[model samples]
Target: MPSLRVLNHAFRAWRRNRAWAKHEPETPFLADLLSGAPTCLHVGASDGRHSYVMTQVAPKAVIYAFEPSAFAFEVLKLGIAWHRMGKQVTAIHAAVADKPGELMLVTPKKSSGRMGRAYAYVAETKPNGPARPDLEDTGMETQMTPVVTLDAFCADHAIDRVDFIRMDIEGAEQRALEGAALILDRDHPHVLLEIHPPMLQARFGGSGEAVVDLFLKRGYRMFALDGVRLEERTTLVADLPWKDYFFIHPSRAARLPDGVFKARMAA
Candidate 1:
């Protein structure tokens, strides 16, 4: 049995997630794409609220959720068992990067404003930009986490088909994308990423355009949701107005709802 504090935290997290999903424009689209049995990669999975939501929306979806923070990973595992989603959702205790190496995983001791364990991220060097301000007051701790490339992880796990990938690994999106080059080129899975321009520039000396270029060069069209409608994005500026965007390969475009993504209104 779990402790009272753990149970209370779980309840609060569940409630918060429910409220968050209600306003999220991508939630319905996720349901649409994941209605059937699909292989999903949930990078920066935190305490597994999103993975738990995936299980609810797509009962047969096999989710490989990765979280580097030890504290968050424990919470994620507890949630997996609490929800009885252990069979469908596999939690991995590692960070994804461009190469297989080790990085320092920084996590706050408690919730820092709206940010909590979910904001935990791995860095090869000291964090900067938007990540810098948080470190000033938040009691922080670091753990050396083993990093793995998506391409290697999939090849080793024999995941030939990845239907969808939800990545929100702070500023390390580009590196993770680089690591998954093989998967991106071969499977062309639907990628939904949260691109933080300041974080990107601070951590990797890269910008949002660089992240968009990764998909554009691969013949992938990126789209952003305007409330519930999907609008095509031709170019990504250095300052991104939106954080979450969808990167879909031309071949996979047909899988999405024609009415939503087909209109192709420029963003």
Candidate 2:
């Protein structure tokens, strides 16, 4: 039998595709920015749904997907095998962070030993201290997971070029970006990131603007989906309405079709 989580994922994908068919604007699909034989990273890939989408859109695209949670990694591997996509997607079990080290992954308590919860996050750590183990009250459990930096991973795998990256690592986006600075500088891949303001502040002790600045400082322009059109953003407020954003380097902006963005900020 399929896991309940896997069934839920399938339902969500069906609904999303139904919406797109109705011409309801959702987050712009990866097809908008990807093309032939691109090298991509699906960081924080859970269950490999996005990776499957990548294969559907760009058949020749090679993807390296990283998932930290043991349960999620199992599901991801199952999906890969189910889809027979082993040749195109390489699923690895590890967290992507600012440095290559171990971190505690905190996830909500599950109903059974075999079931898995969603939206697990990196446990908060004190300065020069170990991960906090006081999450019991929050109905969460922690496990130590191997961590790797994008720069080191790419170099180790001999991956010289990256065309696109989609990251949704809970509130650890800033840390992942810090880890990928080398690749960001060299490849300028189109990045799709989800900014969790509450998680950023409460868990990571950071802000959305700080994450936005990470891209702006690197000459990457920010754009957000408004459910109707994409809007270029120069800054983000505390109560910013959107969560997902596209941080496109200047070099890749031309490939995106015209009129898709409002261009609120000059490029």
Candidate 3:
């Protein structure tokens, strides 16, 4: 077995790369959320890498990460146990879908590491057509597994509210939200969502704006769009095409202090 120091270093490296970008150009929205040390719910947290960050920043808060992939769930559980944070962190072996039950979890045969249903959209829109390509060439496979909606899971677990939510469920954001209407209506947590426009349009017949509209109608405000566009330092795209967006409830906007806001502006 690897030494404890070695394991810690390895876990840190994995989080730095696979988790949210630590050095990415900061935005007021993210700084605001991180500064508050809020309780969070992470949807489709494949291996709970980002969940680690949440716990680090908010040691007193609770985090529930929902993941369906067996391999990913196993590793995530190991990471949580290794850190002795089994109490602060809760890992669920379920995917966020239209309902609480089983569904297909498609992944590349060779690289189950990058498994996600969002990839299904890419598969469906492949230029050649809709057919399972060679595993080596495509690096994915379509497998079935049980999925559950966040709302149902929360209800079953007796979770009353969430302060923040991070969703990266491939292209299943809309469905997840549809099932989480109660949480959105009652708890009003800040949400950080990754919306793949092409995938949303191709697979779900929905536009990215529709997802944004869902939150907007529920009294949430778009705070920032973080990712490639900021790093590239170019004006070509003008708007972020492929990236993560952060949204927060307007009522809680005052929780973000001026110092945090200034730090992000400097970044």
Candidate 4:
């Protein structure tokens, strides 16, 4: 049996953590959008932790969180329930791919809260001892799960429009965009995409520049968070040599400061 005081302390800790999950870093980009209380679609929502913030920012906004991993699905469901956001947030057990159908999604058994077949992280190489000492030492197994395209899922669910979209589908950003052609062309939702150029090139035979071209052709501008100015010459470099970068659409360019969107290309 736990003491009453101990139980109360534990409850308080839980509440604090839950609050932290919904509000941390205080992103200026999101803060600007929250003013509109816009509906959001969160792709690659690992456990609904970040999605929880959408609810706090836009109390009336409906949030759709898409995730496919079984373990992550369970965690997201519990997180939604724990946060008591059943009405405000929805958890979709699906992966955002290039088409609207079932596909195998490779999920690593040991993930650092982010892993996907679409985005393959480079294996740390070690000095040659055996045929492949790294492979033998790490022994990481990839888990496959069912995946579907974002467009198909949205059409099936009758979600015609979303005010904001946040995608962090590992390295599947390009394919996910391809699947969301209709939404991109018609609704033109404000998009926040996480780009993993190295993974994109190594796995999909596509380059980050190609992905940027696709969005730019579709009337989207790019931006970097943390108040960095976007310039035509300024490339999207990962914080670390091989990390990830964020891109924003042009229509929502105003949400970011003048320094962020570079020189505002025609939307």
- What digit string (tens of lDDT, one per residue) describes model 3 on residues 41-125? 8887765666776766667768889877665666677778766678889888877866776776656433445443334422223
Worst 10 contiguous positions by lDDT, candidate 4: 126-135
Greater TM-score among 1 and 3 belongs to 1
Task: Tell me the tens digit of each residue's lDDT in model 2 across 1-267.
Answer: 667876666455445543444321333457677778989999998867778778878899999999998777877877777677899999989999888889988775543543234557776442222222222223456788899999999999999999989898878888898999999999899888888776677678777889999899989888777555677788763475237888888776665534343233224
Instruction: Give, for candidate 1, the lowest lDDT window spanning 10 residues.
Output: 128-137
Q: Give the deviation of candidate 2 from the true structure as CA RMSD.
A: 4.9
Candidate 4 C-alpha lDDT tens digits along 1-267? 445543444354347556574432424345445545566788887666557767776678788898866556666666677778899889888777776655545433223443332232222222223212112222233344566776777788898776777887656778888888888887777666677775576555667777777777876655554434333423575543233334456665665434333234433
Residue 71 CA displacement from its true place in model 2, Å:
0.6
- Angstrom error of the Cα, residue 51, model 1: value is 1.5
Order the numbered candidates by TM-score, best leading: 1, 2, 3, 4
lDDT of 4: 0.61
Model 2: CA > 4 A from native = 1-28, 110-116, 124-138, 237-242, 255-267
The root-mean-square deviation over C-alpha atoms between each candidate and the true structure, in angstroms, is 3.4, 4.9, 6.1, 6.9
**lDDT tens readout by residue for model 1, 53-155:** 7887789999999988766677778888877898999999999999998999866545444345555677876544344432443555668998999999999
Scored against the true structure, residue 188 in model 1 reaches a CA lDDT of 91
Clash pairs, model 4 backbone: 221-250
lDDT of 2: 0.75
Better of 2 and 3 by TM-score: 2
- Locate the minimum summed-lDDT window of 10 residues in model 3: 228-237
Strongest candidate by TM-score: 1
State in Å the error of residue 54, model 4.
0.9
